[model samples]
Target: MINDDAQTRPLFNKIALIGVGLIGGSFALSLKKARAVEHVVGLDRHSTSLKAALQLGIIDSFTDDMASAIADADLIVIATPVAQTTKILSSIYPYLQSNTIVTDVGSTKADVVLAARTSLQEKVSQFIPAHPIAGREKNGPEAAIDDLYVGKKVVITLLAENADQSIELVAQAWRLCGAIIHHLSPKEHDQVFASVSHLPHLLAYALVDDIAAKPHADRLFQYAASGFRDFTRIAGSSPEMWRDISLANRTAILEELDSYSAKLQQLRASLEASDSVALEAIYSRAQTARVNWITAIEAAESQNKDGGD
Candidate 1:
């Protein structure tokens, strides 16, 4: 299954991806595009997903058998939904090679780490909890694109028992797919994502649902402008996936919700008192801060490209 087009050898002999959904498929395709792996063997319980992955050439081969799929795999990516991650990892623990490096694309890291620690036990050293901060509202293999992770940030949660080689290998795989890596403790990763990612999705779903419940909902939606579209875009995300993330990171999410509620109360009081100056200042500061952040990010990206060249 090895295919090397140049002098450099492939980084992995085989990468066993346990899900054929957007994240897993995109990673497989990206690795294939980079010729970074000799073989990508996909495993999924869903027939449609496996079929689509095979037809689209996202994987070199696929299997429904857990043991067979991961036999001698140098790297294993557990890309199943957050809820199923623990069960999947536990099932594949015995099948993984001694040197196999295990990583995941789950949005929440604490629950995943707990699952690995409890299920994998001593073998947990091979498991490196990771979350690639990339993807779309869309789902399934058809929604996967090769460059979905390019230039995106991937956060890896380092565990106490993890081997240095395992961490390096997992990070190297993500680097091959053009991702910038960041490290955090599993707790820190969960808290950070709850504020920036999970809470927003919950807000979007609430906003969309609130509007849909109105009497003239259809008419209102039809007349909605880019503002509404932009704000509620993530409402179209996979409910199952978001639900798992919300619950898995419930503690941090609840804290964030409380903070947001307090902020909203202050904004509400400002509006009630007709404090136009306060409102204007808030909005103006947000605008400036966002623009500055964007400019800095773009400049850094340009610098990175120039440096790479």
Candidate 2:
């Protein structure tokens, strides 16, 4: 249901998308579907992606020129990899409007915040760091969907210099896209995601790589079951993106890796000693914890659904 009222008085007159990948294209489509933006301009190095976005009606126009893309745009979304944050911010800094509100969909926030601080300097407040906790094992503009963020968590990590108005406007933009907004400090965001998100992806990739390197790799894959597929589903994600994310949040990820390694060691010791009781105890505790977590999430989702009505 498109809101005609919102169309008549959209939140943003023009929004410039710096990358026409899954996140950027989805944002454009979602905003347009909600009638919360009058125009979306895509700016990406890859002409193919921009063309695809334009053809799909994700963006009203496409451009490779930074100045043309940012000029008069009320909001700018940097949807590139975390590795490109500094470069993108630096490129757009010269063309940013006084009232421009810049945000990103980067997976890691601390590095992005540092990049914004370095590139935007005195105007750093204009760039708010955000991480949308929604994605598939896919990439590119063609993979984008308008409802990708529906009911998903989008974390906004604020800078001390950010004004109240700017913060709310950014939050409202995500709200229009049907995202539930959450706030966290940059350090907190990175640390939390490093444990839960980054580590899982890393483990999945590692597991697949380990299996694929064996002489019986073909035989193993041939007989692989649903559990293998489910566990390694995220291993199919873009290597470039995950590489950048892992490097960007290496400090927190390394700490998490060490903690996880310690736990693995404990499990290995239990197995070596044939300690069935200890192994069963550990598995029981983990099962109980996961069940509680899932129950809490389901309850929250139900509450949110009821409230939405």
Candidate 3:
């Protein structure tokens, strides 16, 4: 029951956030701060996260029952892990209002879009698939912050023409959360994120596993430096969530993994041959690319802030 006068400001009457973890809690905080939602209700399988969200005042009310939580929600945000999207959708599909707009924060889009299309075709027009490219190694409601998505990228994948209204509402929601929204086809979204997001997670997991498999693993770990620590920080992310993402985007991930393997083999050959020229070239290219990417990201953030102002 948000103020009716706020209705013209992209604020919803009620927002039901399913799975109140980091993303869900962040959404709630942003909505409250922006006065975008009159009331926020939450649902989560974990009692600890639900309690933390409540303690943080991220939600007005919460429940374990999905239907009860989303009954009259004008906006429904599915913030569960990618694998849980279908299951959660099934549980709440029966309770969704006709005009209720649903969106997700899952990393991958194809699987989620297909799941919604198959299970809730009648309401699929109200469904908008989105992925907020903002997160930290830390998770749970306790780690949530109001500015988590500030100056970050949010991808919205719209497959059906009838989803225009839902897409606009989803974009407005992210805008209120201080995010820049980009529209991409589900296939394009999966392919792009497979390399940028999925592959990085895989690399982090593999790097940690490789280090741990060494004969003197403890000795190696003891000597790990800032670079090693920073690169592997995401390896600390929820294994259950990463496991789902890895499996869901298996095709694209495998392709990228193969490409990475080839590069690794090339570097190994160069090192074995004492090919200083090749090594220097590879290192120099990587350094330049990293610098350029950092510059571009900073510029984007600046532009986003300016636009908001």
Residue-pair clashes per candidate, as listed?
Answer: 0, 0, 1
Candidate 1 Cα outliers beyond 4 Å, as residue runs? 1-8
- Sorting all predicted structures by TM-score, with the top scorer first, yields 2, 1, 3
lDDT tens digits by residue: candidate 1, 1-73: 2234345778888888989899999998888888888888888879888889999988888887888878888
Give the CA lDDT, 0 to 100, for residue 219 in model 2: 97
Top model number, TM-score? 2
Off by over 4 Å in 3: 1-4, 7-10
Task: Provide the lowest-lDDT 10-residue window in model 1.
Answer: 1-10
lDDT top scorer: 2
Candidate 1 shows a clash count of 0
lDDT of 1: 0.88
Query: What TM-score goes with each of the models?
Result: 0.95, 0.97, 0.94
State the weakest 10-residue window (summed lDDT) of model 2: 1-10
Better of 2 and 3 by lDDT: 2
Residue 263 lDDT (model 2): 97
